[model samples]
Target: MTFYAFAKRIVSPILKKMYRVEVKGLEHFPEQGGVLLCSNHIDNMDPPILGVTCPRPISFMAKAELFNVPILSGIIKKLNAFPVKRGGNDREALRTGLKVLKEGKVLGLFPEGTRSKTGKLGKGLAGAGYFALRTNAQVIPCAIIGSYRIFQKVKVIYGKPIDMSELREKKASPEEATNLIMTHIQQLLNENR
Candidate 1:
């Protein structure tokens, strides 16, 4: 196994035991090939939690600032995470994400753009939708609950992939497409709650 795979194998179990995580719909994840895992952001722990629990290597677009920290950057890189600027146009980050997908690897995205302090979902960003439309990749909608609460057993629900073919012909704008994606994510979160 690769270093990351080996590290994940070792670290994942430890994290599960430490956090007492409960994940549902893991079978919903694609058994193979490149896929986009879109989820709602609740806290900083969301990415690692999803990463450790999921069966595949999920590379996420982390803020550029995090990568500037020497120690944290090393850890983030080992976890298959990449850097993206918070504000302004981050074309490089988008390009990097696309490259990962092109290499047939999974890419995890938070459509909300940032963490939700209230544990409530936020409006979706167009990057995820654009990626889906451009690559024709399967968009797996995911919901993470109770992650905002410390010492709580967190729950993660993975919904069936959203078919982009249906929306491919629609006249909706990028923003509209993003909203549609968020709506589906919200539905899954609501149903689970």
Candidate 2:
């Protein structure tokens, strides 16, 4: 069996029992492409949940520190997670993300950059926007409500794929593209509420 399938088979049942996650909009997920799934960062479980819940395999840029853990490093790597340097512009991480997408895989990203300990969404970082525009990939804004509390009801809503073709055609600045992407994410959150 494929490693992803194995991992998902193991993780999905546990998460489902503990969190009771409700996911909507599976239809919006593109069948194939360099797609970006942009989500808010609220809880540590967010990444793993996305990996399990999404229809396609999801590759994410995890904090480099996790990779330093002896056993965890090997496990997450096998699960299709890669490390990104925490503090600055991580070019290597960006390149790796591009490579993942270029191979027509789904690249999952957290627009807020870090976990919102307060559960309040923060300004979207430029990375998701910049990457979507640069790669001409479709951005699907996702909202996870009440995921911070374990063993509670969590709702994950997937918005339609965002078309940012103009950004690529115009060669927009990363900051500008990022702002647009953040807006879409914000809209999704607002719509859910």
Residue pairs in steric clash, candidate 1?
none
lDDT of each: 0.84, 0.84
Residue-wise C-alpha lDDT for candidate 1, range 84-121, written one tens digit per residue: 99776799998998888878889999998999978889
The 10-residue segment of model 1 with minimum total lDDT is 146-155
Candidate 1: list runs displaced more than 4 Å. Answer: 147-151
Candidate 2: C-alpha lDDT: 0.84
Quick one: best TM-score, which candidate? 2
In terms of lDDT, model 1 sits at 0.84
| Candidate 2 runs further than 4 Å off | none
